[model samples]
Target: MAIVTTIRRDAVTLPAAELGPDNPLPPLRPLDEMHRIEDRDKDDLPRDMARQIGYEPLRSLLPARVRDGYGRERAPRELDALVIENDRLRATVLPGLGGRVASLFHKPTGRELLYRNPVFQPACFALNGAWFSGGIEWNIGATGHTTLSCSPLHAARVTAPDGGEMLRLWEWERLRDLPFQVDLWLPEGSDFLYVGVRIRNPHDRPVPLYWWSNIAVPEECRVLAPAEEAYHFGYERRLRRVPVPSYDGIDRTYPAHGVHPADYFYEVPDGRRRWIAALDEDGEGLVQTSTDVLRGRKLFVWGTGTGGRRWQRWLTEPGTGGYCEIQAGLARTQLEHVRLEAESDVAWLEAYGPLSAEREGEWPGVVRAAEERLEACLPRERVEDAYAAWRPCADTEPDEVLAVGSGWGALEVLRTGDKLPGTPFEEVTLGDAQVPWLELLRSGSFPEPRRVGPPGETLVAPHWRDMLETAPARPLTEYHLGVAQWHAGDRAQAVRSWERALPLAPSQWPLLRCLAVADQEAGHHERAADRYAEAFDDLCRERRDDGETWTSVTAALGREALDALLAVGRTEDARSVWYRLHPVTRERGRFRLTEARLLLAEGDREAARAVFDDGFEVADLREGAGAIDELWARITDEPLPAHYDFRMRPAM
Candidate 1:
């Protein structure tokens, strides 16, 4: 039997090394140049789209208003890199670089538990661009790395309640009007580093937020977790299933599996406390265990194949070995949104450390050893008690217009009339006015309707039109009205509304896309093609200016533009727009299929076949065998496979 040692707070003593001026790491580059994408064209697509819609570009829309304090460039300064250490373990924090954990080292084995990039190399992989591929990156906000990932955070060195040293990193999330803080502590003699995160909504209304911790590790590691299945979206954002960690009982360790590069979000069973570890063949590596608040674990691997190698190069500098990510999420999966109510905050703790096996055949013993230590560090009772104490109080207000609450694995919003049975509601009789819940939700606004209940999708146009007539000249309002009109099938009215909205928010990519769609539907193919091109260009500019990356919606709009250009016989323009898309987006199987279709239409069967083959490779990577079969069916004029859904359009 193997002996397991549990560390306690009182038994440990602090190490001698201190985090001060004398032990600073390299200073970050200037903010202006840090996140910028190079070789981008100086085309103002938003301005051109605005002109096409018969409006001038709005000055107010030069930079996104939601992102406060983001447009201005900060002066270069030498920032300190803080470190917390014990006799066995050491952790470093880079405050200037999103306060990321720069390095986690195990002294006895001289191993780096977390991948440490040699320099701050910002790449265009995050929703808000500027993502560095090493260390544990804190992502908070809608999706991807939050707007704060590349920005400097306020830092402080404090003493924990048990007299342990801690490094606190904090900042206001300007876009969401929330304040978030992270406290990192390395106890005196423990081999683990603890992380505590708090995100508080300070406003009167509720805000939607998403958060994930992306921890990078060496590619030659095997993830150990007790999940039976993994979920990922393949072509067209359709959900696809695959086995976790392995497909055929054989462990699909990194760089060893025949599977294509893909994102894997494992579904953890309910009521189970899960711990995830990424260990090398020698059974030595990092382990992450968290409190109940974090319910999901994910793996992102850019495989060792050609496409994977290309992506690895795109994310990091040359000669830097590729890495795999072990991620943890606040929700059941990535891309799911949660709400933080007014004055409410969510808190959770995560502990990371080194784990090693006693012998090669005793790898499971290492997992058990880590789990025992983690259980001792953060007992289930302590976590539950902390949650009970910190959980938000229920809302008792009767007249609240939009009540936001979170439970049952989703963020739920209730209007007065939409309340469930047994819930309290005001008796005052409000009129027959309805609210467009979906539209309002998408627009990031609270519905101000006279009555409750859900509104009809077609009725959204009239509501927004009425609001625009009486309300102030709000660009967002006008934009909402245009979306409503478009959805309601009032194409001309939608175009007109977008025309009015463009002058107030020219940089709004969705408005440009809406206009382009309207034009395309109206048979103005040339105009639509030009507008689509403009929209894609404008999105690229917005990313370069704001560090935003390609979203599914934006990617769809780009595809639409490409199709429109091809329809108008503007093949060159279509090709140019296709090239402008992010390399990640362009590598998708759907986009490759589109390219192949276009080549085939242009009477180049050989080129089309080659493109189709390339797309087939990508499809294989995405586990999109169904898509490959569909493409073959289209090329050979044969019936699609029986399981394939013919009615469903190909993913944009």
Candidate 2:
């Protein structure tokens, strides 16, 4: 049958909470930043591998601000979706949600190749925040889910490799200041969906790059890759080599066989085809294979543990069958970041489709049959050739615009005058957040706001920072420059910049928070607490609109402030800040944890115990967080409940 591809507009209405608005306050330092520099030497990794692991630590997320502004409160909302279909498959892409392939349905088989998350629940999972679970997600730029996980992407209908209509999703990744595009299309009568990805570094210097295609598959499936030994990274913050299928008497290849959440990065040997799959007992499931450049493949299991299950429930709704992630990336592990030389780019093609394991033996026979099926359906040569065919199409201008993403990309283009041919970040997309930065680029001066409010987003790219440094010496200029410096790992300089801005700032809270972070890092706990207290006070007293937007601000800032105050034995002060928080905010799992800490600090052990007894779930729990266990120990001698246990490592 002749191949025919078509792309059309569609809608998917799910119970999704509004992303509200981007938090104006830049997150100075966050907890996950500490994990970026894991003990590579301790892991006994090769020196070359260890160097890549610690290549470039993500010091601060300045250029892109924190996105913890969303809440659990949700309502039915229709989201813009783009559907691309061929004879054998149909892919429904959510252009509004990072161009996520919301559904990949195999027509003949009537099977969904990816985990179709039932609801849209925003959790603090992304690097910025507000990441939802589901479908095939394109993760780029450093570790964790991309900041764009919950944000929109620039999508358009473009010509495909086989003269079919293709859907193209493009975005300028803010973290690495790189432009990338994803081209998705289904060939004529082909069961596999082809995705071509490209990441470009348009700078004079080399940049650290990370890319991963995260496909969520049903938890019941057994994941198989091309390697026997895998790098195991558990919540204990340790990475060690271990056998694949069986680890500690459990066939961990089956997602639920593990006892806790962990990562198994398959060690695909050199010259071997890169692929990963999640199939059932009969060997029927999805298989993802990519060209050589995209080398790494992984299995991320949430495990069968109570905490893991609880987290699963927290992300969406209960009874929505559990899931585990099968991902492929540009490095051996997500911890390592490869260097993309100046003016260079990395591109590859990936094919995702169903596999039928016909052979009857054990692990080896099952995987071999699946591999043969994969080769029959979509040969490796065809994939490589399809990539060659798509290269030119990747640069083809979109025929029609389907959706628009953040204008941060356009602003960067304005500042640099760099012409991106296919992935154009049009100036028309420029919005409120990019306005001030626009002025800085055009007029060579960082303009102050008409009235005092939270600081807008910061720009930490070298070029943007240089502009800020040369711009007029206003407090606002110094403030953002300090943020850029802090992001660049210049702590002392960032402190000086914030201190200079403190005297004449329009909003003292933003500057105060940054300074407090510096103070805390310097072991000036008392000073840090005082600064945090003042910052929270400034925010509470400031004139604000009555909405969840500001409510998010207070909750975020208040939590940071409360932690600081409690660190210095200021339980009363912490309590006051906690009370000033919105009732809804106070009820959140994180804040509830804060409340327990407050009660304990004030010598009210019983009250603290009750806080835990109330039963709460921290939806945004860190991957390897031991806080719950530690806090539980502080309150009583009783064993921690299963639901609260997220310890990823075996007890020492």
Largest TM-score belongs to which candidate?
2
Model 2 poorest 10 in a row by lDDT = 33-42
Model 1 pairs in collision: 127-549, 128-547, 129-547, 236-651
Question: What ranges in model 2 sit over 4 Å off?
Answer: 1-3, 33-43
lDDT string, candidate 2, 1-652, tens digits: 7547889898999988777666667877754732353573445886666878888857666577777656677889998899998888999999888889989999898999899988898887788777899899999877788888888899988889888788899998888889999999888888899999999989999999989999998888888887878988876767788986787888888888888888899999999888998887776889999999999999999887777887888777798799999999998888888899999989999999988765334667766777777888788999999999999888899999999988988998887898988899999999998999899888999999897667777888888899999999899899999988988889999999999988898678888998998999899999999999999898888837487567878887898889899888998889889889988888888888888999999999999999999888775666566788999999999999877876656677
| Candidate 1 residue 208 C-alpha distance from true site, Å | 4.1
Error (Å) of candidate 2 at residue 60 is 1.4
lDDT, residue 129, model 1: 38
List TM-score per model, in order: 0.55, 0.95
Runs in model 1 lying further than 4 Å from the true structure: 1-88, 143-147, 157-159, 163-165, 172-177, 203-208, 228-245, 253-255, 317-319, 339-343, 358-370, 373-498, 501-525, 530-567, 571-652
* Residue 184, candidate 2: alpha-carbon lDDT: 93
- Stretch of 10 with least lDDT, candidate 1: 21-30
**Candidate 1, 1-652: lDDT as tens digits:** 2112212211112111111111010011111211111122113222332222222111111011112111111233343566667787777776766777878998879999997765454443444334557889998765455655565665555444345445666655543545666766665666777777787664567766677988999887777654667665322343346665556564553534634465677777777675677878787889887777887888776655544565555445559777888899876556455667776778887778886632223334544565565567556565554334322211111221221111110111222123321122232311122234333434545344343211112223244345444544456556656655554456677678778878767465666776776676567888878788887777666644222223433455666778788877887887787777767657665577778767766677778767754433231112223444555665766553332322222335
Angstrom error of the Cα, residue 58, model 2: value is 1.3
